[model samples]
Target: MNKQNKHLPNFTQAISQLIALPSISSSQASWDQSNQAVINLLSAWFETLGFTITIQAVPGVKGKYNMLAKLGSGHGGLLLAGHSDTVPFDENRWLSDPLQINHKDDKLFGLGTCDMKGFFAFILQACQQLDIALLKKPLYVLATADEETTMAGARFFADSDMIKPDVAVIGEPTNLVPVIMHKGHMSHKISIKGQAGHSSKPANGINAIEIMHQVISELFKLREKLNLSYQNEAFDVQTPTMNLGAIHGGDNANRICGHCELDIDMRSLPGMKDQELVSWLSKALQPIAEKYPARLTITELDPSSPSFQQTPESELVLTAEKFSGHSCCAVNYATEAPFIQQLGCQTIVMGPGSIDQAHQPNEYLADSEIIKTEQLLAQLIQHYCF
Candidate 1:
C-alpha cells in the first residue's frame, strides 16, 4: 500500500461503520430516516485523507445531505459517486441485524453491503493506493442521499452546476460490469370523481367505476402505442412498458361508485421524456375528460428520472471496458446516471457486487470481491487522476 493509505481505515472497517448507520430512504414516513449521519462520517473519513470536504443539504429535502470530497485540482477529473442511503429493510426477514455487518462463509451481510456502501470502501481503498503528489487531475468522491426513493441529492447536485468532471462513475451494484444504458421511471395517479347515490336508480348518480373503465381502456391504448412506437434492442424488454399497479373505487355494492383511483408506473426508453409521456397520457384521456368534465385528474406521484445512455465509444466507457475486462451493456433498472450526466460529463454506472442481491433480505458481498474491486478502482484512479 502507498504511504498515504496508512492513515485511512481498513476496507472492512469503513464498510462496517457505514452499514452500522441506518440511512434508509423510503416514501413511507415510518421507514424514512435521515442520511446526515452517513454523510458526516464520510466527510470525516475523506477529510482525514487530505481531501477538501463540502457538505450541502439537499434543498427542499429536510434532513438529507450530499458530500463532495476533492483530492486534487484541475480540469477533466474523474468523479466517483455513490448514494449514501439504502432501501428500508425488514428486520424479521433477515438472519441477523440488518444494520450490523455479519461475516460468514466469506461474505459480509448487511443492509447496504452490496447495494452499495461497500463501493465507498472500494473507493477509499483505491485512493489509499494512489500517491496523491503525482496526480495530474482532480479526483472527486460524491455521496448523495435518497437514491432509493427520489434521487433528490443527485438532482440537487446536477441543478447546482457544481463540480464538472470529465467523467463520472456511479457505483451502483452491477457485479463489476459497466452499464451504458438504462430506462427511465415515472408514476402517476389517475383519479375520477362522481356523485354517490343509491344503486336503485342508476341515472341518479354518475358511476365513477364506469368512467374508470373508459380511462383504463384509454391507458391500454396509450401503452400499446408506446410499445409500438419506441424500441431499444439493447435493453431486455426492448420496448416501453406501463403497469397498472393498483386501483380502488366504490366501498359498497349498494351505492354508485363515488370515486376511483388508478396507480400506474411507466418505464420509458432513452429518448423519451417523462413529462411528454404524461402529456401523451393526459391527451389520450382527454376525450373521456371532455365527456365527463371536471372529474378526471392526473397527478405525478414523484419526480421522475430520465433514461440514460452513454455512448459505448466514450473514453470512460472504453477505459472501464478495457480495465474491467467486461463489455459495456444495458440494464433495465433506472439509476442516477442521467442526473450526473447533466454535468456535461461522460458518465456510466459501474461497481462491485451483484444488483440481484440489492434490497433482498440478508444482502451480502463476497469477500473475494473486496480485493478485486479495490484493484480495479486503483487502475481507474491511476488512468484518470494520475
Candidate 2:
C-alpha cells in the first residue's frame, strides 16, 4: 500500500509545472499569458501521447485557450473536464511562494494545486499510461479557461459541436466523492433610479435609496416565502436562498440620493428555473416602481444554466463510485456539471482536495490526495478505456 509507487511520478511533475504558472482568472495579464502557456505545454504532451488536440479561444480574451484532446473513437466514452484558472492571491499572505509547489508533511501547498490543477495533472498522468490500441471507446480531456470568474470557457464549449461523450467528469475539488447533484448560483444587480432633491424637502423629490429599501424589503419577504414554499430532500437547504451581497447609494448625506444599486446572489434548486425566480421578483417590485418616479433594472451576472442531477443508477455514477470505493452524495456548490449535462450526457463533480481549500488565501492540496487522485484516474482508464 505504498501510495507513491501506486501513482506515476509524472502526475507530480505536472502539478509542479502547472503551479509554476500563476493563472489567476481575475488577473487579466497573468491569465492571458499563463493560459496559453499551459495549453501549449498540454497540447505538446497530449500529441506525444498520440491523441488529437484542438485549441479554442474565448471571444474577448486573447491568448485564453480551451484545449480538447481525444484518444480512441466511438460512443459511450468518458470526458474529463477541468478549468485552468485560479482565484487571485496576494503574494504577501502566503507562507511559501504561491506559484511554487511546496511539499511538507505529505501536503502540496501552492495556488491552483487544489482548486483544479491537481485534477488536470491526474488526467494527464492517467492518459500517459494508457495504450490507444486497447481502448474500446474515445477518451477526451477538456481543459477550459475562466471557470472561476465567468465560466465563459464552459459556456462556449457547451454551445460548440466539440466531442461530447456519453458521460462527463468535472474535476472540481470534491474530496474524491461523486457529486451527482448541486445547486446553481444566479448573480444579479438591481438598480433603482429616482429624482434627487434637498434633504429638507424629501417629499418634493423621489428618494431612490428609500424606494430601494422598500423594494429590498419586499424582496426579502418574497425570499422568505419562496424558502417556505419549495422543498428538496436531496439538498442540505430544502429551499432556495437569496442574499443581497452588496449595496450602494447616496453620494452625499445632505442630498437625497437619486440612485441605488444592490447585488443579489440567489441559489436555485435543481427543479427551479432562474426565470421563474426573476419573474416573481419583477412582480413584487412592480408596485414600488409605479408608486415613485423610479426605474428598476435587473442585470444578471454570470447567469448559470442550471443545477445537474445525475441518476443514481447511471453508469457514470456507478463507475465513479467503484473507483473511489465510496457512496456518492449531493452538494450545494455550483459547478460546470449542468452545462456539460446539456449534451445528453450524465455528468458528476468528483476530484481530490476539499472544497474549503479552493478560494482561501493559503490554498493548497494534500499531497496524499493528489496521489490518491492519480491512482483513481489510472484505474478509471484501465476499467473504461481498455
Candidate 3:
C-alpha cells in the first residue's frame, strides 16, 4: 500500500468495517435493510483524501444513497464503481457471523468480500501517494446502492444524468479477469386465477393447475424458438435461456385447483430486450388464458439488468485486458456494468475472487487476490487517471 494514503486505514481495518455493517437489500421487506450507514462510512473515508463527495439520497427510497467522490478536475476520466449493498444471508447456514470478517483457510470470509465492498478497499489502496495535482483528468469512485435487489441505485444514477466519465470499471467479482460481455437478467411471476370446486364435477369449476400445463407447453415452444434464434459463441450457453423455477397451487388432491402461480427467469443475449421475452410469454399463454376464461397477471420480481457488451477493440477493454493479463470473455451473470455504460462510459467488469464463492455459505476472498487487486488497480489508475 502507498504510504501517503491516509484517507483509509490499512486494508484489514477497511474491510472489517465494511463487513461489520449490515446493508442487505432485498425485495422482501423482511430481508431488506437500509444502506445509508454504509455510504456514510465510505463518504468519510474518501473525504480524507481531499475528494469532493456528493451524497445523493435516492429519491423515494427510505434509507439509500449514492456516493460520488471526485478527485482532481477534468471533463472525462476513469470511474471506479461498485455497489454498497449485499444480498441477505442465512444465519444458520454460515460457519461464522456474516457481519464480521473471518480469517481462515488463508482467505477472508464475510459478506461483500468480493461482490464487492472489498473492491472499494482496493480503490482506496490504489489512491495512495497519488499526486492528485498531477492528474490531467478527474478520478471518480462511485459507490451505489441496492445492486443485490433492484439495482435501484444504479438505475437512479442513470436517470439523474450525472457525470459522464469516459471509462468505467465495475468491480463485480470476476476472478480478476476482464469481462467484456454478459447476458441480461429478468424474472417474472405469473398468477393464474380460477374458482375452486369438487374434483368429481368436471364442469363445476376450472382447474388452474391444468391450465398451467398448457402455459408450460407454449413456453417450451417459445424457448425452443428463442434458442434457435439467438446465439452468441462468447457465452457457454450460446443462446438465450429460460428456467421455470417454481410453481405453487391448490390445497387438496381431491378438490379442483383454484389457482396457480408460475415463476420464471430468463437471460437474454446482447441486442435482445427483456420486454420481448415478457411479451412472448404473455402471447404464448394467451390461448390458454382465453380458453379457460381465467385471469392471469404478471409481476416483475427483478429490476432487470440489461446485457453489457463493449467493443473488443475499444481502448478501455483493451487496456483492462492488458493490465489484468487475461483476455476478455463473457460471463453468465448480469451486472451493473450496463447501467454504468449507460452514462456514456465504456465499462468493463473485473474484480478479485470467483463468482462461485459469492452468495455462498461463508463466502471468502483469497488473500493473494488482495495484493493482486491493489497492484492492478494502481496500474489502471495511472494509465487512465494520469
User: In terms of lDDT, which candidate is strongest?
Assistant: 1
Candidate 2 lDDT over 305-380, as tens digits, reads 5767889999888989988987888888888888788777888899889999998877888867866787888877
Q: Which stretches of candidate 3 lie over 4 Å from their true place?
A: 1-7
- Off-target runs (Cα >4 Å) in candidate 2 are 1-9, 27-34
List the candidates' TM-scores in order: 0.97, 0.93, 0.97
Which of the predicted structures, 1 or 2, would earn the higher lDDT when compared with the native?
Answer: 1
As a whole number from 0 to 100, the lDDT of residue 193 in candidate 3 is 89
Summarize candidate 1's per-residue lDDT along 190-291 as a digit string, tens digits: 999988999999999999999999999988999889888899899889999899999999989999999999999999999898888888998999999999
Against the reference, the lDDT scores of all candidates come to 0.91, 0.82, 0.88
lDDT of 2 at 270: 82
lDDT of 3 by residue, 128-152 (tens): 7587778998899999998887888
Q: Residue 18 CA error for candidate 3 (Å)? A: 0.3
Per-residue lDDT of 320 in model 3: 88
Score candidate 1 by TM-score against the native: 0.97
State model 3's lDDT: 0.88
